[model samples]
Target: MITRRAAFCLPALLALPARAADWPLRPVRIIVPFAAGGPADGLARMLAEVFAPRLGQPVVVENRAGAGGIIGTGAAAAAADGHTLLFGSVSMTIVPHLQAQPVPYDVVRDFVPLGLVGSTPFVAVVPASSPIRDVAGLVAAAKAGPRAITAANSGNGTLSHLATELFNARTGTAIESVAYRGEGVLMPDLLNGTVALGFLTLSTVLPHIRAGRLRALAVAGPARLAGLPETPTFAEADVAGLEVDGWQALLAPRATPAASVERMAALLQEAMADPALRERIAGFGVLPASADRAAFAALFPEEFRRWGDLVRSRGIRAE
Candidate 1:
């Protein structure tokens, strides 16, 4: 007596497609929230090229830089179609935590996390001629002359700035912070010794570090960098409570279908496993890191809370 109703429903369910087709029926646009030639832009290009073939559509990378990445991110947030996605980074997580007004987008509410692409550690460096040979010497100098040691970063509320602040808080030192439009623009001052110290990615300072123009004091991670094995980690350097690493990720406008999000995550995970892709990404000085949708999505709220606390305690304001 199960009846005709049960018999009719079974066949209808069986007729459903075994598996969904590859989405991205047309060209896809990836919005990079930074200018060309920068790390974010470079990562976006790499992702677009790698992701295109997987989705069977051309993936285009576009730079929409303004207001410290707010404009581009906002545009992506407002985009309803899944065709437009955002190449987000630490800035995306850190900015809103500092802004007085509510940010245009909610990291957890407005964006769907696709995956974590990778992370690169920043190195603490000093001019080649400086007597500060290691972390201890640099800390001693900063302690002796509060606010005398100046460190330059891309801008306020940026990873570099946060790195320095975290260092200061941990070491109990008062180091001055100078913010610039971008890391590229801050190089001249660093090379010329206008800035006494700098906390930047090893990629940004690799040439100089290899040229013997700047000496690496320590890396802001748990372990030493593969490229610079001799340099010690923040923990090894004995800098109390200091550990920071800059990262990049991919996000989509909220409300994208779960099927699409899962598809992107699976493809990205596959791409990350490709040896050739791994080599290329490592060449940029970032290790290729990937996670499934659930794992990646879990990180946003934690990051938002951590950065939010720092912003409130330090009173960081966007410039």
Candidate 2:
């Protein structure tokens, strides 16, 4: 017999299949909350190319750069279409804590982490001519004089900035951080030997390192990079709490359907598994670290707390 409850439940059961089938009915937009030509934008475009055919729809890359990625991230959080996703970076975890103003979206509440694209290690670099050949040398220099060694970073609250702070806290050095608008501005000073040291991503500093303009002292990761085999990791250098990577991930609005998130996760897994794709990402100096939805979900909150604690303890602020 069809009871009153069964009658109402029947419609919802029928709708589930329809919702799953109708997903990706239109173009999927991946919002990159940074200026074009940066790593996040490049990654978004690459993912778009791979996701389009798999999702049976065009995956459009949108740049909504402003307020240090808040504008686009907020837009992605508010989107209910399920077709719109966010290509977020470690900044997503760090920025909210650093901002003086209230953030529009909550990392844990407003979004679901669909997948982790990968992470790239930051390198501790000095000008090619600097005598500081390794982390220990740099530390000794910093201890010689307070704020004597100027440590430059791309911006305040960035991974580079936080890493520099962590370095100071862990090693008991007072290397002052000088924040710049972007890497473009920071690199020039770094190359000119104006800044004593920098904590920058491999991609941003790789060209300089390869061109003999910058020297890599250490990599902030668990293991030494294959390309920079000679460089030791922070842990290897006996510097703990500095082993963090600048990671990117795909996230959807929290209200997005479970089926759609699962499908997106599968497509991302397939894309990351492709040898050609992995090679391409590596060419850009990013290691492919694609994880399933569950893994990413677990990783996101931990990162959020980790960065938050760092920011608060250091009193790091964003301009």
The prediction achieving the highest TM-score against the true structure is: 2
Runs with alpha carbons beyond 4 Å of true place in candidate 2: 1-10, 13-22
Regions more than 4 Å wrong, model 1? 1-19, 291-295
In model 2, pairs of residues that clash are none
Q: Write the per-residue lDDT of candidate 2 for residues 1-319, one digit (tens) a residue.
A: 9999999999889776435556788899999999999778988899899988877899999999998889999999999886899999888888899888879989889998888888888999999989898888998999887688998998878888998999988999989999998778888889888998999888888888889999999999889998789989998999986887888889889878888887888888888989898787777778898657788889899999988998999998887
lDDT of 1 at 102: 85
lDDT of 1: 0.84
Global lDDT of model 2: 0.87
Please give the CA lDDT of all the candidate structures: 0.84, 0.87
Clashes of each: 0, 0
- Cα lDDT tens digits, model 1, 223-318, are 888889999988898885666768788888886666677787788788877888778888888878865567778877777778787888778887
Candidate 1 backbone collisions, by pair: none
Candidate 2 least-lDDT 10 residues: 14-23
